[model samples]
Target: MKLVKHWIEKIFATITEGIVGALDVFFSSLQKWFGVGSMPYIFVLPNLLIFGVFILFPMLLNFVYAFTGGTDFFPNRRPWVGTANFTRLFECQNFLVPNSCSEDLFWRAVFNTAGYVVAQVTVMVAMSLITALILNRSIKGQAFFRSVFFYPVMLSPIVVALIWKWILQENGLLNAIILSLGFDKMPFLVDANWARFWVVIISVWALMGFYTLILLAGLQSIPADLYEAAKIDGANAWQSFSKITLPLLMPTMLVVLVLSLIRAVQVFDIVFAFTGGGPGTATLYMVQYIYNNGFASPTKQYGLSASSSLVMAGALIVLTMIQLYVRREDV
Candidate 1:
């Protein structure tokens, strides 16, 4: 076994050295030809090309599609309609009432997405904070508990949604438990309110662990001497945490807040897999709205979908700007 391991290590080392040597020779020749000043661009060219082709090009195309009346997939064939798509989306008799909008489903999706972002970000931050605080404490089986909490984060969103859907469905595990407790079975996914509630709950359950881990790392990075000094000053646990822990953790918390907000705004997969935006579009969000208009709907109005995505992107930009301004003011 030892002999085999030695030969395997030697072979890997030889291969690695050969590859490095070839790369050095190739780059050295290129550097001599192109001059040292251009080497940075040369090295970064592949990534730049990839980003341009895959990300930047698609984004510019979407902008073009947003302005065009496009039932056609080809850009040249799509007729220019200027801001008509945006006008249609904003056409509302009463913006407060989605039913009064020209594009009522779009308005409904906007309102739903707004509500979901608020609720999910709030709950996600709070639950993550609590969980991280607990996990940071001296407790028995701490590692085991941490892993158990983080286990849900490892599951695929579709799988997580499916598992929760089964539990929440009528005649499923939760309903069975309710019946055994002498209570009537309740509609979970079949009702609008219940479906919305469960969607938020399940999303929090699936994603909270990731945020908790972030907060835990933030907590660990805080120096213990600060807490000890606070203790020596006759500070209580609450005072120590507020004065020591929270201040140091603010940057991490800000990261969590921004990430959770962005994610909450873009929420679709779990809600889609769990409820399919049913119970009369209760869980329908911006991404799903874009998907429906872009591809799922019979009409396949790509222009409207692209316009909607641009609107969603604008909202995200606004959110990020607001957070940045707030952070700057604090600093």
Candidate 2:
């Protein structure tokens, strides 16, 4: 038995040595051919190729598609329309009214997305900060509670949507509880306002956990002696938090803010699977608008969708820039 084990170990060691030798020879050849200075770029070549193929190429194609007009999926078949797509998108008798626009649904989606972003991001950040603060303190079952909060983040967006949809449906758990308490069955997803309400709530519930963990990490990173020093200086809880914690945590808060903003702007899958952009297009967001135009519409307009996406991308860039500027100023 010992002889057999020794033989097995020897075989494994030989295989490992062979792999290491092969890798060393390969790298040595690369260094000889490309020079040592280019080794970093050579090492990074795979990631660059992947980025170019997947991200960079698609971004460039989107620009091409945005300038061309047609129902055709092939770029060659599509005709160049210059800025016609943008012109049509911005065409409006009155900017505020959806019915006044050439692309009424697009405008509706813009408004819906705007409202949702504001409501969702605000609530999510606030809730995450509060939850993080709570969890930062010593408590029984702290690890259990942290796990519970973070569990939703592990769920697929589709699964999160489906779970909420099941609960908010008329004959679902929520309605059952309402009836059990002798209350009327409310139309949670059937009314526009209610659909909008639950959309924000469900989104916050699904995502707040991730931000909570981030803020919790930020909280834990703060020096314990800072709080102790604050206490010695006659600082109250609020004073300690506002003076010491808030300033130190601002960087993490900014990161959370920007991430949440981008995520809220790009909200689609969860709301799509949850409400399907109805009770009369009430929950229709920008991404859903793009999806509907690009693929789901009876006559798909790839140009219009691409143009809308570029517009959305521009908004994200502007938001990111503003956050970065704020962060820079703070620094």
Instruction: Go through the candidates in order and give the C-alpha RMSD of each one to the true structure.
Output: 3.6, 5.0
TM-score of each model, in listed order:
0.89, 0.88
Model 2 misplaced regions, further than 4 Å = 1-38, 323-331
lDDT scores of the candidates, listed in order? 0.93, 0.94
Writing each residue's lDDT as its tens digit, candidate 2 over 1-331 gives: 9999999999999999999998998999989998999999988999999999999999999999999997899999999999999999999999999999999999999999999999999999999999999999999999999999999999988999999989989999999999999999999989999999999999899988999999999899999999999999999999998999999999899889998998899999998899999989899999999999999999998999999999999999988897787678656
Model 1 Cα lDDT, one tens digit per residue, 104-141: 99999999999999988999999999999999999999
What alpha-carbon RMSD in Å does predicted model 2 have with respect to the real structure? 5.0
Candidate 1 clashes between residue pairs 3 or more apart in a chain or in different chains = none
Query: In model 2, which range of ten residues has the least summed lDDT?
Result: 322-331
Off by over 4 Å in 1: 1-37, 322-331
